[model samples]
Target: MLSQPFNPLPLDELTAVFARIKDLLLTQDKVDRALEVLVQAVGDAIPGSAGAGISLFDAHGRGSSIAATALVVEQADAAQHDLGQGPCLAAWTAGTTVLIHDAATDARWPLWSEAVASLPVRSLVSTPLAAAGGPIGTLKVYASLPAAYTSATGQLLEKFAVPAATLLAHIQGPGTPRHLSGPLKGALAGRDTTNRACGMLMERDGLTAEQAFHELLRRARTSGAPLSRVCSDLVDGRA
Candidate 1:
């Protein structure tokens, strides 16, 4: 007979877990380190998660493993990049979450599904990292058992996604010569919005970085708006 599904964590314990994650994000100064911590937190917080990872897209939209709780997670991400389609990529492009109950039988991404069949992963959930400009990447949890993630697990992960996005945006933004303190960090976060907006345009329209900036400039000029405002609109999809 098959074993029972994993039980969800207690509400109070879940809250405490998130509190610790918040502290982790606040204390981390580097993006890479922050992502490493974030993935570890996911593995710790979610029930039945064998591993967790962050898959980031470069300026050119090439996906790669940024961080992972284990080597299995990294290899899983690499398999998706190799196949050129997977739940994580779908989540990033659609700006929503994607769940696979069992990769061995999932037909949505046939190539990716077949490729990962030999791995320990059976079920997975990929949630988009919604930054100020748009979705920059995905946070994914891998499970060695089928039907591993439940509604409660998904909800918990969703709650974590918000601050995860902000922390990631701050890390991807331009860095100061010295460690930022006080209001400078907030100001830099705002600037990163524009930078991310430009990146989105470049990825979407196949424009060079300079061309992307000019496009933003052209839009702002024609619409009689500030560059930052135009970028914010683009980032938030008002443009």
Candidate 2:
């Protein structure tokens, strides 16, 4: 329905919107309730967005929490998990943004596209929810119309993802870990991953142990990402 260029909220207004989400984070006691409200606000706030969803995943990429503004969106996300391929999962695993202009006409994930063809889910943008060490999952917004989201929309969504993820990282509720779904646990896992990544850098470039570590630091600094995230990218062969 929307063919015009997408103009997202101004930076100041957008910050105010996310500030509200942050406030919700502090007021609510239940993670699920806060998540639902947050998702609904997100869907309503973004122009042309039919729905919004947030999915949290463990280190192994299994979902730990999932919330959506509408049932159709819930089903759409479930299809991604069931089919094992979709924009959100791609964003989560790759620690990058995934934007699909039209799932109906041109789908990079043909299987998932076919699965959700009957639903009002065509254009969407998903961004990895990056935290202290690495991405914890993804936050996505969906639109019913083809080409509903433009490149600018994707960029805005990425900007929105940063603070959104920050609030989510601090959410507390029943069965929710106080930090990053268990910061200590994630840190321990990150340590192992970091060690293996250091080894990979050492072997790949024939650098000394300290030199390899410095290289990892350099990558983290240049990329403006966390060291553990840099290590994860290298270990996952994405760096």
Best by TM-score: 2
Sliding window of 10 residues with minimal summed lDDT for model 2? 179-188
Show model 1 residue runs off by greater than 4 Å: 1-30, 172-239
Question: Would you list the C-alpha lDDT of every candidate in the order shown?
Answer: 0.70, 0.72
Encode model 2's per-residue lDDT on 67-113: one tens digit a residue: 78887778888887676567776776556788888898764678999
Q: Candidate 2 overall Cα lDDT vs. reference?
A: 0.72
For candidate 1, the 10 contiguous residues with the lowest summed lDDT are: 176-185
Off by over 4 Å in 2: 1-5, 172-239
What is the model-wide C-alpha lDDT for candidate 1? 0.70
Tell me how far the alpha carbon of residue 107 in candidate 2 is from the true structure, in angstroms, after superposition.
4.0
Cα lDDT, model 2, residue 46: 76
Relative to the true structure, candidate 2 has a C-alpha RMSD (angstroms) of 8.6
